[model samples]
Target: MHMDEYELEREASAPIDMLETYYRALGWEYERSGEDEIVSTFQGSWTQYELRSIWRAEDQVLQFLALPDIRVATEKRDAIYETIGLINEQLWLGHFELWSASGLVLFRHAALLEGEDGATLSLQQAETLVEAAIEECERFYPVFQFVLWADKTPQEAIAAALIETQGEA
Candidate 1:
């Protein structure tokens, strides 16, 4: 699970022209959707995640998203909303948001930059932001599964998902 070597190499290569450089250096499959948006995919232990980064130059914010592509049934959304709230409370950075219109759940975080800093972030910061987003999504993938497929309550799902086993089975 340690990608430190890859991140370190990218972080030391040069200043980041865009956040996607960090992902690209890691050999992530990605493309530019626009001048401000980059979309990529990452394979996790539990799922394939669609990752995106958008640079809001006017606002000086770089926003990242990681989607596991789970679609919540309308009937399950209320529970999912509760599940999202519970999961977000445990997160120190970024948050899980249920896109009500699309019934999609994804992780979102943003790096706010000073106007003088422009749209570019240091490679280290870029690595931290992108990796943290992906890690958060990976960490919580099962919590949503427990809610959607197992009928577990938000509390129960969070409790189950957060439990750490001592040794490999």
Candidate 2:
């Protein structure tokens, strides 16, 4: 029996199946890392990031994470912390956290898609969240560079990364 994408699995497998199908439909490069996870890479102007998403069927949640291997000197961690605090405030979705052990900064977001029937994970929501994550990464990637390489203070790095939008018709 053939099933439409939306109605493929109402309550069968985990949400990863729906997410996998959606990624294929969009022609994105992704790999099914496991039965419940998919990893996809996206390139921004400054660098490329691998976005790993996992489906937690039991919890009825989908979590997305992107972390690039950026070297952060021990001395600069404080600046990065301050910058990310300011950055998180400006972000409409998702947030950044520093994995101090590995010196890797991570961006994370999640979507809850469980209801009475089964799951409501949609292609639009998946795409929108991923796009938003990437955009957020692109928007703040320069801040890291400024703080680490240029030795800019946290405030200066944030100011440099912000893009002021002017109203223009």
Candidate 3:
């Protein structure tokens, strides 16, 4: 499946409420995660699907979306690839790839889609999401840069990578 490409623009910093409102206007449901994070869910049979945005201590904004299909827990290898393709196309991202351990599909900008790492969404759309997330960070905290990721699994490989790196260091 091939994903669609969209453009994202950065916006002024604001509170999560503002970001929630923006996404809500786009027909997404918002749920509060931690003190400075939010998970936005898209409506439809695609329930349990959510986008998470986190504001770090230094004001860095991290964003990503998770799409899970529990029914494919024990499917074959090719099925997993097909699932990845399906998600890539549905999200309209540039590219999608599979993760080894968790079997998740990561989406991001095509440039970052290399290796056995994350996937790539359209840089344009990512810029937009980051801009929104940045506004929320500025309102609630102090945000520096906006980081975004997308995956078909509920687990976050980026977070896992951070933890592993920290432990190793």
| Candidate 2 TM-score, true structure as reference | 0.83
Cα lDDT of model 2 by residue, 28-111, tens digit = 798997777999777777788888988887887889898765667788899988988988998888999898897788899998
Write one digit per residue (lDDT tens) for candidate 3, span 74-158: 3444545654453345343333455656655433222222222323233454446644433222221100000112332322433
TM-score for every candidate vs. truth?
0.85, 0.83, 0.39
- Cα displacement (Å) at residue 111, model 3: 13
> How does residue 11 of candidate 3 score in lDDT?
32
> Candidate 3, residue 118: CA error in Å?
27
Give the residue spans of candidate 3 off by over 4 A. 1-11, 15-17, 24-28, 44-48, 57-59, 68-71, 82-127, 130-169
Global CA lDDT of candidate 2, please? 0.78
Residue 128 alpha-carbon offset, candidate 3, angstroms? 3.5
On lDDT, the candidate that comes out on top is 1
Once fitted onto the true fold, the runs of candidate 1 whose alpha carbons sit more than 4 angstroms away are: 1-16, 115-117, 164-169
- The residue pairs that clash in candidate 1, if any, are none
lDDT value for model 3: 0.40
For candidate 2, list the clashing residue pairs, or say none: none
The TM-score leader among the candidates is 1
Global lDDT scores for all candidate models: 0.79, 0.78, 0.40
TM-score preference between candidates 1 and 2, better one: 1
